[model samples]
Target: MAEVEEIKNLETNKCKQNKRKPWDDGPCLDRWEIEKFDPSWNPSGMLEVGSFSRAYPKRREKHLLKCWPRVKSALEEHGVSCELNVVGRYMSVSKTKMTRDPDIIVKARDLLRLLARSVPARQALKILEDDMAYDIINIRRMVVGSKEDFLIRKIRFLGHNSSSLKALETSTNCFIRMQGNTVAAMGSFRGLKRLRIIVGTCFRHDIKCVLWMS
Candidate 1:
């Protein structure tokens, strides 16, 4: 009985020692052979879509038509597709069957948004690059006064001949456009950060003061 018990203990220890961890398992067959039999591994047909709308698309129709071909071709090079709906005043981008990089769709979306904000198509294409960024700062709610007061602030923000505006752009290395009540800016990340600070100071203090400091 003692010998049998010792044998049993040895067998249990051996079993524990022989037990393989999940990470210890090796592939039994080639990766291609295994994937070939996987019914749920198909990713080629998956689609992702991004849509955009603007307040005034009619005004941009001609511009869009002129740039759409180039935009479509550019996106196609990255395995994405784009479409413009003149009647609906919207643009849409989607991943095609050839799309391998998931982040390309997001870049395409940003491209459409920049274009919708009246950014020149040539400049807007820069959003497709890795280090480019953009921001839309709403100045309408930044003031605490009437419309006239806001207008005054906006005027101050853009000095005579837009000298103050150009100075801000130069100091920050950003391209800025004042569209309605929002300021659209695009550049490198560092430039955009500096731009936000300059815009805040322009609205909070005097544009002349900010320009002088810069």
Candidate 2:
């Protein structure tokens, strides 16, 4: 979580726009500090491609077909090993039903992202807290740095619900947030990339002024 905050302060809020996003196409090393980046620094690029769909470039129906395998392979190639878990589904054992899962899931962050414009944070944090518990349980076997150390970049946040995040302060990187409660994005700015997409309306409609997260 702290690492995510640190990245938000780096490139996302720099206001230095280019043809490609810093995350999707930029080097991991800082441009000013290092002349050459470590060639081995090959973390999977956080794919927050557009304002509407996070990581999901298109509709979620083809999520399995499009995003998962490439990301999984890329992480493995760089030797980042963690269980690949899909955490967004609610199953029905009583009868067969459609199973909708986001493209990729890291931890509890998916709750807000998967919500789209559905629920409010005040209403949803409970579930998110539980999911966080589940997240820690699932990743208890992680052998590397703590969960707060992992970096997230170039992700999208589609809704206006900025409950606890410091997104409004302009410190984060490549955030691409949709302002206010409106489903459509207000504009793009930089923050840690962790936006998600789900089926129903689950968040506020427009971006509010001056977040309380700080």
Candidate 3:
């Protein structure tokens, strides 16, 4: 009986030792699979080794830093200034995440008008607004989104100046809206104090986010 008990204990210990691995938890595919790896049988049809995906996981800060500088530089090349602010929720002893959700936001007025138009513009505005309003004050700034991406929405792309005015009134409070056909400015952050509250409230991406304002 004692011998039998000892054997059972050994078996249980071994079972515990077989811990699950990272790949066992979730597959990392979004990072990009390394292609043309197996150059033996078919030199042209090599399968992806998946080095990049395997190398790191997506962490918001890292990803933003990695891409943001290049993106900012590119924008400057075209004569548009760029800025980024970040807000943090918490810190964790995490793994190799390459990208993370943007806690910091980027913002600029009519920044992308020259590049593209419409849905892409609206999408960019929405993302920017969401991030800016994030609780992380240090990292909060209204960042601009890509007009190319904005084109996807296709709906809140454009509006007659008169209609947008109605939207501004019904959408937010105490803010002034100056949208004369094309350019727009819808914000409660008016008159001197620059409260940024009223506009903050009614600020919708496409439907309400101002086109341009002086």
- Window of ten residues with lowest summed lDDT in model 3: 131-140
- Candidate 1 clashing pairs? none
* Residues 99-181 of candidate 2: C-alpha lDDT, one tens digit per residue: 11122223123433433333233332232221121111111122135433211100122223443223432433222223232
Candidate closer to the true structure by TM-score (higher is better), 1 or 3: 1
Provide the clash count, candidate 2: 27
Residue 191 error, candidate 1, Å? 1.1
Ranking by lDDT: 1, 3, 2
Q: When superposed on Cα atoms, how far off is each prediction in RMSD? A: 19.9, 18.1, 24.4
Backbone collisions counted per model? 0, 27, 30
Model 2, stretches more than 4 Å misplaced? 1-61, 82-214
Q: How many angstroms is residue 43 displaced in model 2 relative to the true structure, after the best TM-score fit? A: 17
lDDT of 3 by residue, 76-160 (tens): 4323334443443211111112212112112323223211122123232432332121111110122234554333222232345
Q: In candidate 2, what residue range of length 10 has the lowest lDDT sum?
A: 91-100
The lDDT, on a scale of 0 to 1, for candidate 2 is 0.28
Quantify all predictions' global Cα lDDT against the true fold.
0.73, 0.28, 0.31
Of the candidates numbered 1 and 2, which has the greater lDDT value?
A: 1
Give the candidates in order of TM-score, highest first. Answer: 1, 2, 3
lDDT of 1: 0.73
Candidate 3 Cα misplacement greater than 4 A, ranges: 1-145, 151-165, 173-214
The model with the greatest lDDT is: 1
